[model samples]
Target: MDIIVEGIKQAFILLFTLDREVLGITWLSLKISGSATFLSMFIGVSVGTAVALNQFPGRRFVVSLINTGMGLPPVVVGLFVTIFLWRNGPFGFLEMLYTPTAIVIAQTVIATPIVMGISLAAIQSLPANLRLQILALGATRLQMVWILVKEARLPLLAAVMAGFGGVISEVGASMMVGGNIKGYSRVLTTATVMETGKGNFAIAMALSIILLLLAFTVNVVLTQIQQRDRPR
Candidate 1:
């Protein structure tokens, strides 16, 4: 307990001192996770809309796959991206290994499932009457989808928040694909681990604190949005 308290004290000092390494890691984490979340939102929303509105063979199976993907282990995602980007892998010629792009790819893989699954739930939760009413009004398929999506905006926003939280806090994928390279691909979570291994508890604690604050801020904002959009 004493050790932990001491670490916290030193971490605050580092924060106030404007430690360069700490700032660098925080910036990289935000940059990579933000990019990954943006990409995931694009793909996930498109696929989720298609799956929700279209009835076809194996639709249930596809949604089941997405649900399973929501719980996918970050380490597994890391391994998958690593192999695909490795020197002997299919896209090895692109030489994307150990880069910020690789980290973004890994994070995207992890986040997409969350976004897709959440979107599915949101779309499915809408009232059947509402859907039927829209159809009765002779709305086009695209118009119907947009209406449903707008009605479920709160849930979709929650999905985005969940994906952002997952990607921002994940260390395994970031470390594996980004190589935790100093001043390069290093992020807050990966940097915390690296600093701890080097016996730098102060910086590690500081990074952890910053990460927690970011996660809290995201959740708070999402909750506000959800409340504002809640059906009265």
Candidate 2:
């Protein structure tokens, strides 16, 4: 009880004073997660839409794989990513291990499937004849895809929220790939974990509160846009 109250008070103090370490970790969290979510959005939306609109061999199998991937464990993702980025691994020449960029890659892998699965469902839910109608209206294949994407914007926004939410709150991959070095790759989730492990519950709680605030702020903005664009 006392600890919880103290933690909340500490959180406000950190925010109000703009503590350098706290601010840096907060910003880095946003940067890594934001970059991951953006990349996931692009790749996920494109591939999911392609898969949803096209019929080819093994399509069902591919979608099943994607749906499975949406629930991939963060620790498993961390293990594979760490192995791939380790010295002497396939892409080891790039030397990206234990860096913020590595965290972004791991997070992207974590978030992409989530966004893709949601987007696949969103696009597939639209009217079946919508594509044909767009083409009959003299729209090119590219334009048709764009219009369909626009029509599914609402649910797509949900995809963004889900993707961002997944990656931003994930710590296992971030810790494994980032090394949690202070002022370098340390992020809110990893920082909280470190603080907690050291019995710094107050600090941990403060970081957790800040993380919730950050996630809430981003979701709020996205929700506002989503509601504003809702169809009457």
Best by TM-score: 2
The TM-score of predicted model 2 comes to 0.97
Q: How far off is residue 83 in model 2, in Å?
A: 0.5
lDDT of 2: 0.95
Instruction: Residues 109-129, candidate 2: write the lDDT tens digits.
Output: 999999999999999999999
For model 1, the stretches where C-alpha displacement exceeds 4 angstroms are 228-232
Show the colliding residue pairs in model 2: none
lDDT tens digits, residues 148-192, model 1?
Answer: 988888888888998999999999988999998889998999889
lDDT of 1: 0.90
- Please tell me which predicted candidate would have the highest lDDT against the true structure: 2
Give the clash count for each candidate.
0, 0
Which window of 10 residues has the lowest lDDT sum in candidate 1? 223-232
Q: What's the C-alpha lDDT at position 14 in model 2?
A: 76
Task: Give the Cα-based TM-score of candidate 1 against the true structure.
Answer: 0.94
